[model samples]
Target chain A: MKLRSQTRVILPYLGILAVYALLMAVGVPWLVRRGQLAAAETGAGFNPTSLVIYVVVISVVGLFAGLYVNLRADARQRHALNQLTQATRDLGEGRFKELEIPEDVGPLPETQALKGALESTAREIQYRMEAILKEQSMLSAVLSQMTDGLLIADDNGRVLLLNKMAEKLFMISQEKALGRSVVEVMRHHALVELWEKFRGGESKSITLEMGVNRNFLQVVGIRLDDEIPGRSMLLFQDLTQTHRLEIVRRDFISNISHELRTPMASLKALSETLLDGALEDPPAARRFVVRMDTEVDNLSQLVNELLELSRIESGRTNFDFQRVFPCGLMAKACERMTLQAERMGLSVGQECPDNLPQIFADPARISQVFINLIHNAIKFTPAGGKIQLSAWQDGGFVVFRVADTGVGIAQKDVSRIFERFYKADRARAGGGTGLGLSICKHMVEAHGGKIWAESEEGNGANFFFTIPVAST
Target chain B: MARLTLDRELRLVQDEILILGSLVEQAILNAVDALRRRDIAAAMEVQHNDRRINNKRFAIENRILILLATQSPMAHDLRLLAGMLEVITELERIGDYAKGIAKVCVRLAEEDTLIPIREITTMADKAISMLHRALDAFIAEDEAAARQIPLEDDEVDELYNLVYHKLIQTMINDPQAIDHANQILWVIHNLERTADRVTNICERIVFIHTGELMEMDSEDDESEDEDENLDTA
Candidate 1:
């Protein structure tokens, strides 16, 4: 340790001064008496007492001068030692930012070496800290940008680290979630249960549903690569939309089977009747053949509608855009459905306005939508029932309607009527293809329009659609 | 000297209790999820996993017993060891309730569901939330958080009452639905008991914090059967 005070620095020099003064007081007088004795023997004219006084005076002055020089030199060494001590203390506390030794105090060789060592030590510490920071930021950047949620849990199931995607997947903030148990933050039993099963290595992947939004997450728990005791990683991938699509695909298969089987059964029965001696009777054979042909036509139409609907839904079907008069389209649809309405003993009429704004749409597809609606109306309406086809401009689009005084749809089935192969109770009596309304909905939606039905059970039904008006 | 060793033992006991609590919570959640999905395999897995929860509780109990035997813990340390023993007991019972619910799931696997499954789910959710918060209070040694946990149990009770009446109404309307409704009622009862166990855990937390063993949960006045069961539990 450095001697800090000036008195401490000068105390040893003062002690040397005292010892020298005592020696001069005793030994110098003894030597002076001997010298005087020698001078008398030599008979020279010398003053012995004066010589003794002169020697004492010179020794006192020289001792005082040496003491002053010794004190200043010791103080400089103390100052140099103090600066080294301060720098060492700062380095001990890890305050590498300010490890400078004052230039004037540490001018000595030993202090200079000490300062050089401190500077290098501080530089090494700083380099290590910078390297650590860089690695941390790089790892965190990669984790945050990843689409999969990554969660690292300690042995006791506490959340040690979580990435941005993990925050969104678990619907918890990373700040509030750290050090909390997984069950506390996730709040999903499936994930907690998975962690338990995961402990035994029984299951790796588990599906968890989180929050009121019902987000489905497929969490895969993987053991950390270096066998870190009590630490594991969980990767979460959202699978809600995929699961929904799977359900839709399954439902469509069952619906298509039910739809195709009825027509197929009818065709089989008619063909069997003709083969079972109905061929011998001309009128019976002719009637059976015609019914079989109709069934075949219906089956083919169902297939055609299914293909068309799929094409439109998959965005493969393209539209030929044109400004078509709504009155002409309505008139043409009514004309096409006139025969079917007459056959069903229903009155079909057009109620289009003369100056209705033209619509930008695919004419062929629009005609297909209108034809399906009118055919459905003719199929369900009783004899003497009236079907009205109307068109008008509303808002940014021209709205079209096909209203029927028919056995209207039940309120419960109205929402699902536009789904593929969804046949209402009264519509099932008509035995037409079930994909008609679904195709119409897909076609209308493809044309940037919407279609919906307004009806009451045992009352009339009105199906309305809108197409964007042509910008003139 | 030996004081540091005793402190380390106390920490080990605390960690064991937390681990056991999490295991029991996981069991309950898995049991309820199995019930919702009607997955008999998942329900069976929950039942099988109850053994692990039991083993963990017993392991913690053994550690605490050894700690108490070898060392003389005074004041706060003594209270902590005693409180851990009591808290683990409550946790074990909660695990039993989860096992019971898993058993109900197995029985109701093939039956047509007549009652609203959403109500039962709501009851499970409330109970699980209470259990989670109670464990958090215990770990933090927060007396106020522990006191607030029992207040949340009232919501669980209300849900239980709602589930009870709805199940009873179903049994009254359709004679054929009686068997299924009875099984569902048992499931909801197990969830309610789990919520009750959570309150007991909170009470232990209060004891750990204040060194005062006071009943912090409110009485269920509406159900005489529930009150009787609570006393026995």
Candidate 2:
């Protein structure tokens, strides 16, 4: 039924025709000559035996030729069939090898058409495979380089894909995280809760803390369209630093209000007393006026300190870094605090090692630090208590300590004593504002130094600060 | 066609197990970080996410069951499925230990332990790295690498002992720190148990590769014996 088999029957007939023609040419001539001789001799037309021999020779030749031709055609068909089968299978698997039709086989149109279809199909598939590979690589490139953390999850909360940023933010590896549930990979309950809360189509945004860094991630989850079939995408933006700054800003405002209220209340009370006929008594009027002036001065000092703190914190404080004598700064600080010490009946002394190294600092700010520490020492120390200032070189910096024989800070309060507006003593017994130590900390830090306190309650307090020695 | 689907499903299960392993790894690191920072939020998060790890274990187990029932895999393929079935339990148990550490961190939320957590952190670092390498060996199917992974557990156990002794001394010196130090001791125990689970995973990797379930690392058993001796004394 095949083209090759049909040709097999026809080729044998062609071979038979060739053999018959040869026999006819030779036998007709020979028989004619023989007949002429017989007519001359005994009138015989042709030799029957010669005719039979010619017929037999022709039949044998035709049979062998037909068999050989048919066998060769069958071999060629088999070779072409193998080639076509292999090529088709390879093409289906996205391989594009050329079809190797056998060389001996003639132009078989059906097989040619099959080969053409395969080549074209292979070419089309190859092009599609390349395009898909390129698109996949491009997608992964985008995912890897994205800055914000991104995760795509299925309806069952299983993670389908995550970027490198998401991996880092969640402290998970992408190789291991994909196909796992997002809750397990992220390991943050707030995030899992956030996902659940937003999956219901109500809120799309929620903030949650995740990972070891407690990274505050602002997550927004959106349900993908039905085309993606129950998949959702989440975008995570880190907001830890922003949230901390916001809290700091809020506390700054509240602390400022509390600081201003005390002086305002005192001024109001003093003014009311003066206006309510306390002016008729001359001594009482003078006392009230002095009190009002002091309260006004306290308000002005609070405003100035607040401005200075903000300036230093904002990195806007100008620094004239210069080499200064440690002994001279100590003398200046002690001289400034002498009146306050005497008023409080406390003895103030300085003990600087004469060979102490010079420090690189903003001289005015450094002097302010010393003056503030001494003021605090004098205020907290009882009458006859001693306050000593000392300085010595420790490593790359010159360390200064203001040791006060005052009612010491509690063990717990020592850590927070240097914080802004934090008062160690709850009673309003000290005249100085609580901003002194905090101001000292900011100034010391600006000079590339450090500050801390050491104390045991009811024993003594020592506040230490260090300034880096000037580079030689 | 059935074989192709089986191969794909087997790969998916392998990936899921690695994901489960890394989840527990992250939980351990986060719990330790939270303890060091005194961060209650991170501690609580680790505790809350433990259930998700258990869920993933069940999912992986179900997939393994499905693969076995449908595909009827043999030899190494069978070993891989069975190994995965056992390994997920190890990963889940490790995750629970991490959650326990997180719970201890929450209990010590207010009180600061005088005992230094450095030794425990060192042990955690070793355990995490070991777990990481074990996962790598499992993925690569490297029997040699898997055999070499549990040798690092000796260092983790040593660090655990150091943390234990240091915590005991801290409690002895300051009786007030006894409650806090006891919580820290539990944390160290959790980290030690996590390292033990990593070794178990390594053994599973060897089993998946060779189909012979011989113990790959006997050092952990010896260390446990020694630890028991110390406890009794």
Candidate 3:
């Protein structure tokens, strides 16, 4: 207040000083010119009445001149001080609004320099702060929306921020997680390891298997220099599905190539043998020829079967389905297997009820499956063994059971019994490009049916199939 | 200009043929592996693949409908598309044949002594060859190859008969052969019929290519099925 008031008082004093200086320059000179006259006029002073009057006038003139000079000096100092005060006010007010000052408060060179500095500094600071704020918010938004989890903690083991993904992965909310202790939300030992690195001011990555299928995710922990003593950022990303699919694709290629190679080799070898002088000996030649023919046939079957399967998988097979009676289907299966059953002396008994409902099925295909099962039953059964085909309605399905008092399937082999090319025993094997039950199961399932088998080693085996009932 | 007909249905039908062809090829390989290695796994795989074939059938059917509705294809294009759908049916049957052979492998694998492995393998090979020829003829529209396939079916028929004869002789020599060998023979027969059907399809191919039907009576030509039963000759 003193500075401001003193500065204000000096401004008007400077105005008075200016006027006094002008008077001094012009009137003083004039007075000097008139000095000889004035001295002559005013020199008459200091006699008691006449002398007292003369002394009073001379002293009064001197006092007025001294006051004017003091006012002029005060005004000059106030002008300098006002410039400083106004410049400070402009700087504080952020003077981008206008770069001008009042005319009465005329700017000095010093005030002009201060105003330029304040505007330039304000602009630089504004640009830098805006850029930094924009980048921070963009990072925050991206982290929050990411699918992978993110965790950032301060040096004191306190949660700083958790994005939405991180919250979902931990099954916690941002509000509940923020400022909470890291140990509270991160219970995994791996995360603890990660957090330990944060404490040690080190960067590391760790993988954890903790998803639906023990899926692995790598968590990378980075120490932030700006964070408090114990802070780090952890990012978790998944890599399981990609890994498994790569293996599956690899296996598929290898398996197909190996499968294709076998038949080709067989064909080449057999044909070479047949061509190599088997013709010289009639009997030997016939056998060689037959073997060669077999190899060729094998190759063709392999190719055809592959085509068939790919076709079915690709949804190119047109199936003709009809509502056919299970009994009739079983009867056809019985007839189909009758000769084999008789040859084996296995008594084949079919117990398909006459009143059994017609099943929505493909008759030819179903009959084919039954024939396959019955054939298998006969093949496994010993002489005089019983092979029975029984069909009955049960719980929205028509069940067909083929049982044989023959060599039963091993429990371990039962699951793969319907797989194509799967042969549990090659020892006393019969002739087959083993694909029957595999095709049967698919055909049955295509009709919305199910097929399975029950068997014990050294006992009997039974194949059961059910066609799902469809209401008319 | 040859004036190629805009047979859109033919395009979809071709897809079905390719799909079915691939499936049958898989089935044949699986069936053969099942036979040679007595592989239950391969058998199950072939069976599983049949579902894909079935699904392909339906998809092809839908595409065919679209083709028929949009293209209004006539004559050859119509025949080819319709034939492709039929071929899928046959390919599915072939898949069943492979399945039957696999099932036999599953069962007879346990037997102490059954039919000769080489013989069954030979029959499967012949049938598969017939299928290959049929597919080739279908794809290339090769009438001569298609017409010639039925003669090859005779060779498969001979093998089928041989399996029957060998099994029967063993059964006659010892009644114990009845149970296992008989079923093996039946499964073998199913595979043999698969070859027969392949020849039948080959004939269809010939008919398609030549625009004339020429059915081969290979079954009658060889007379192997009944002849094997009456081996008095």
Best by TM-score: 1
RMSD of 2: 10.0
* Local distance difference test scores for all models: 0.80, 0.79, 0.70
Candidate 1 residue lDDT tens string, B1-233: 79999976676566667667767777777788789778799999988988988898889889999988999888887888898898999888888888888888888887666445667778877887788778777877888988888888888889888889978988898989888888888788888888877888888888877788887655843364664464332
For residue A299, model 2's alpha carbon misses the true position, in angstroms, by 1.6
> Best candidate, DockQ-wise?
1
Candidate 2 segments exceeding 4 Å error: A1-124, A165-203, A208-215, A342-358, A379-386, A394-396, A404-418, A424-432, A453-462, B1-233
Better of 1 and 2 by TM-score: 1
Ten contiguous residues minimizing lDDT sum, candidate 1 chain A: A1-10
lDDT of 1 by residue, A1-472 (tens): 3443446546666777776677678777877787778789998755567666766776777677777767677688788788778887887787777877666653345565676787788778778978998999999999999988898988677899999988986667898889877766665645766877776655499776654345778999887746886688888898889988886898789778877888889888888888989999999999998998888888888888888888998999988989999889888878988988988889888877788888899888999999999988887788999999888889989999999999898665788899876777733545766788999999999888999998997698999999998889
Tell me how far candidate 3 lies from the true structure as C-alpha RMSD in angstroms. 30.6
Candidate 1 regions with alpha-carbon error over 4 angstroms: A1-101, A181-216, A225-230, A265-291, A334-356, A373-394, A400-434, A451-464, B1-233
Each candidate: chain B TM-score: 0.92, 0.91, 0.83
lDDT of 2: 0.79
Provide the DockQ value for model 1. 0.10
Cα error, residue B132 of model 3, in Å, equals: 56
lDDT of 1 at A442: 92
Candidates sorted on DockQ, descending: 1, 2, 3
Q: Runs in model 3 with CA error above 4 Å? A: A1-258, A341-347, A382-384, A416-435, B1-233
Q: Candidate 3 overall Cα lDDT vs. reference? A: 0.70
